[model samples]
Target: MKNKSIFLLVLTLFVIALAACSASGAESSSSESNASESNANSNSNEVIDIVWYPNESGNDMKASRDEIGAIITEVTGKEVEHHLTTDYAIAIETLINNNADLAFMGAVGYVEAKNGNDAIEPVVVPSGASGTLDDAIYHSWLAVDVDKQDDFKVDGEFSLDTLVDKRMSFVSNSSTSGFVVPTSTIIDYFADSSDYGDLTPEDLMEGGSLFSQVLFGNSHQGSAVNLINGNADVAAFCDNCVENYVEAADGEENTVGTVYRVKEGAAEPFNNVIGEEFILISVTPVLNAPIAANLEVLGEEDFKKIQDALASDATANNEEVFVPEDSDASGLFYKTDQERFIPVEDAWFNPIRELSN
Candidate 1:
């Protein structure tokens, strides 16, 4: 009987040990699961990195970029890293490839990027002086040196009919105001002519077809410099893009016959061309440029924040993003009583897209 008691007691102890072991295993599993959940929460809370790509036009506006960047950081709580580019294609590609979170580009560039990747969306665009999209535009000018302006005039008025076989300098084939708008105007105007009925934008890209020679300045400032330096008989650029460096020398501002001369103390490309004047032969209004974002990279929530921040009244009056005419601050936007950034829809650019078709 004593031997039986000893065996039963030993069995009882074994059972206790088995229960303890099972509880320990369960506790370990619970601890590991909690740890994994903690790690996931930490990862989710981590800040996302944002990259901004700017068109070549903004390459020289560092102070303006910093102010804009600060606003973005304030809204997102993430610092923005700028990727400066010298070509429109580079900025467009960067945004389409998801390598950049944001981009500042014209309607053409934004449309192209959206075509490459539908994930791109327009965040905001600077409004006209009246704070309305109806006049939210910039001018595309077909200009010639002051000395050659008379050669482009007919019957005492400026005309594009004399542009045939003239040497031309275009900012970039991808440029909206510099190339797309101006080229579309040329194609439309000459489509009714018997000899040039088959003319296409491609035909004007090379020297032998219509122009004596074709040169791409790669930037608005560069295109204006090309004309002033005698590299091309005529050139295409935007009014506002060169506003900081040029002022009206003859006629009215933005008028087709107006002549603009480089400011005396203008920056780089314009420094040597100072005092040189270019007369506008053609002036066409184009849609305002937009600040575009990659929806996939920014996500809907974060993108909304950025879009709202940019369109806020505070940003409009910041003076740094939209510099006042009298202010010495250099900025991407020019300030007026009602000028501000406004949210835009993708369908708004359909008109620009139609020009290509």
Candidate 2:
């Protein structure tokens, strides 16, 4: 009877001790779960998505994507992610249709996207541009051989009538500043009872854009290369790209520059044909395809988060400059029509756009 009682007492103590241990464990687990939930709620601010990494020129797309992701994640305390696109044009189209969040399209590509969709906004231009223009931001220019600069008396301005039948080189049909804008301007130049005949890219490709012998270098550099190599007598190039030749040469005399200029304004005559500089085309956004967010897809707060992320020093500073500029592009880029990049309208670009279509 004594042993039985002792056994019952011992069992009772064991049960109480086990219950206490279980209760402590349950409290500890509850505290940990509550802490995790709090942290997750804090991070649920906003999220951003980009169509593709701007992997132009064979850059490491993932590294840039990550930098942007980190910036948004930190600033807005939102989870950020990256998306890739195999087709750049498709990406723009997707943005227009509100299928994607934001995209980076080229000069001409932007116009098409804008015409189709007006909900997007323009935010930035290049950093190196001084935003100085003699006429339009981007102008159509004509260049003769520096050796032939003496033939045109051009101090600051030039006319298209100068090269009626000379061999000319232009960038491929796909380019905005290179092929499309310049050709459209030339076509307009011929429309008003001009000495120069109307020309087509087909003609130019077949030796015909208001001239004879079309050498498709397929790139701005190719046009310059053809000019220097004596493959073509004349060349049409973007004003901005012309300096690259001089830059690449580092003043050692490469085939790139016979002249370095900021703008080639409206059509005018070169009075001094002797020792005159060749004309260069400066281009502006006629239809700037903005980095637009699908308002339908990305909520208002989320869209702003993406923009902030791109400009954030945390992101911008870390984001690799595929073509690094000497100065920062942060201030240079803005969403305006005239100040930084104003709405040039789709009609302004129709001349080029029509040809492209």
Candidate 3:
């Protein structure tokens, strides 16, 4: 009887011990889950800094920047800081090094950043007027002074054949529209020529057989100024970058042979070239730029919040962000009935990557 009693006691102790162990395990698991939540909360509350490419760093873009920043701030409950840069490389490096939480950049710059740091990812891109990727594009132009427009014609048709031996200005080597697309077009156009069949982008980077001189404008506005100032015979720039400062002077918009002139009260880089006209000799459509982020810095939860906020209807209908044609608002985005921001994956930019290949 004493032995039976002892056995019962031992069994009771074993049950108690097992219950204690299970409780401890549950506590540990709960503690770990809480810690994870805390970390995510801390990250979400952290301030986000956005770096801008030189093209959009001017004071004229402040309203647009503030509008976009406001949207992010509203959704994340975190303050936002805008880091305006005067150089593309600075903005790119800032994001790659994690000094900036996000960046607004072209496809080439985004590709460069992603190549530099795998953590960088595309968050969203502004869609075309159709509210889809089908028409989400901007134009890259090879332009010259209107007075010299006729000089580029061959057999009553405008052509790129006269570009050889001319002085050229490009926004920057890292620019997608300003350099990559234009150069690719040039290389492809001259690939079958007997004298230049083996032409490459590098050959056109500097002055030599291909050009009389090559100049780096560093910005789209700067490139347009170069052509207007007579510093270059032909210059490369983008339509959206200079659209706010220039007005259509002649021909159809986005069409080759169209002429654009700087406005009367244009801001400083273009101020000196006011009333000057440049005609497009070549125009090629390119994918729209993207607002990219550093996933490591933003953390997954916060990044999702930001991504969803940007793709929401509130952002699309915001006048300050997607300015209307009749509105005098100086902003980055132009609104169409169906225009909006859309999420995109890394593969969306493969075409830009293919250029280098």
Candidate 4:
């Protein structure tokens, strides 16, 4: 009886040891799997970084950065980061230094990048472009408030002659549509640079030039608001901007209570800048930035993999994409085929440059 009891105790002890060993081994295996999975996830989420120039202030570029980052991350199964450049010129240099994989640029910024960098290329164009050229593809509206003008026609045509000595407002000095492009357009239009054509936003000395005075509204909307509030005789800004004003005017209670229209055919976002049904311009082409991969960092295969990942599903359609309520506001996005970056020299925009501007 004593021997049997001892044997039973020893057997029980052995069984408990075996069970503990098995449990420990299983726990070890689980820990190893978890470590491996964490590593794999980290690698999978690794992605490219890109930046955009703050063309329309830092806001527009910031919106783009958030949107692009989400799109790339979704498409490639990798991560993406879009940052805004504090300085336009430095952003290009960042790309050259290989700190970034892509960048979106405006016309002047693109020109600067193209002139300064050899690796830069035109990766894409806007969808509604009339052609591949650099000008006449987009236009701006030059307007005034309904209360201020009250059906005033400026000689019943789109002529700056009437604006010879009128106080005028521009969106901003850096604005492509607000100042630079339109200034150039107005300059070329009159041919005689003697009056409003010769004036520039830089000459805001208040009664220094043909434009009786000059003011800047800081943003496209601000410029339109200035016009609505009677801040200036004329407001030159993006054509889409005027559309919003028109929409606002149609409101029930919030209506701006205005009925402003452009010089017949030059009405825009609808009739084009010149109020013409289809005015073409070879103006400075609206530029599209490119998402590039550094062969040094990602290698060829991985680079292509990243790009393909982005092209497939990480594009503008992803929910993570940070798009503006009004930007391409109506469900517009760029296609991979159309997204292909073309060389700057290769760009050819559809523009009747002279007739349109």
Worst 10 residues of 1 by lDDT: 21-30
Kindly indicate the candidate among 1 and 2 with the higher lDDT.
1
Tens digit per residue, CA lDDT, model 2, 1-357: 322213323333333221110000000000111111112322223434445412221122334334444544554555544445434454556667655555555556566667777765433332213222112233333555555654444454455556667787876554565666566656655665544455555655565445677776654545655665667777766544344232321122223333542222211111112122343322223222334445555666755554554433333233242223442222212222222222222233333344465
Sequence-dependent TM-score of model 1:
0.85
Measured against the true structure, the TM-scores of the candidates, in listed sequence, are 0.85, 0.50, 0.86, 0.52
Q: Which candidate achieves the best TM-score against the true structure?
A: 3
Please identify which of the two predictions, 3 or 4, would achieve the higher lDDT against the true structure: 3
Model 1 lDDT per residue over 26-132, tens place: 00000111111112221122232223332333545776766777777676776565566667777778778766677788888889999999999988888889876
Error of 4 at 313 (Å): 8.7
Give residue 292's lDDT in candidate 4 (0 to 100): 42
lDDT, candidate 2, equals: 0.43
The reply for model 4, stretches above 4 Å from the true place, is 1-47, 52-67, 74-78, 84-101, 129-136, 150-152, 193-207, 240-357
Of models 2 and 4, which has the larger lDDT? 2
TM-score between candidate 4 and the true structure: 0.52
Q: Candidate 3, residues 1-357: lDDT per residue as tens digits?
A: 222212323333333221100000000000111111122232344677788888898888888888788777776777777777778888888889777778899989999999999999988888879887767788889999999888899997788899989999999889999998888888777777898778778888899858889998999989989999999999999999998899889989999888898988888788777898989988888778989999888778767777887787777887878899777666798986778888777877766777755
| Runs with alpha carbons beyond 4 Å of true place in candidate 1 | 1-60
Indicate whether candidate 2 or candidate 3 has the larger lDDT: 3
lDDT per prediction? 0.73, 0.43, 0.79, 0.42
Per-residue lDDT tens digits for candidate 4, residues 218-332, read 5555665566556677776564334422442332321122234333432222333332111111122222333443344344554544444343323423432323334343212
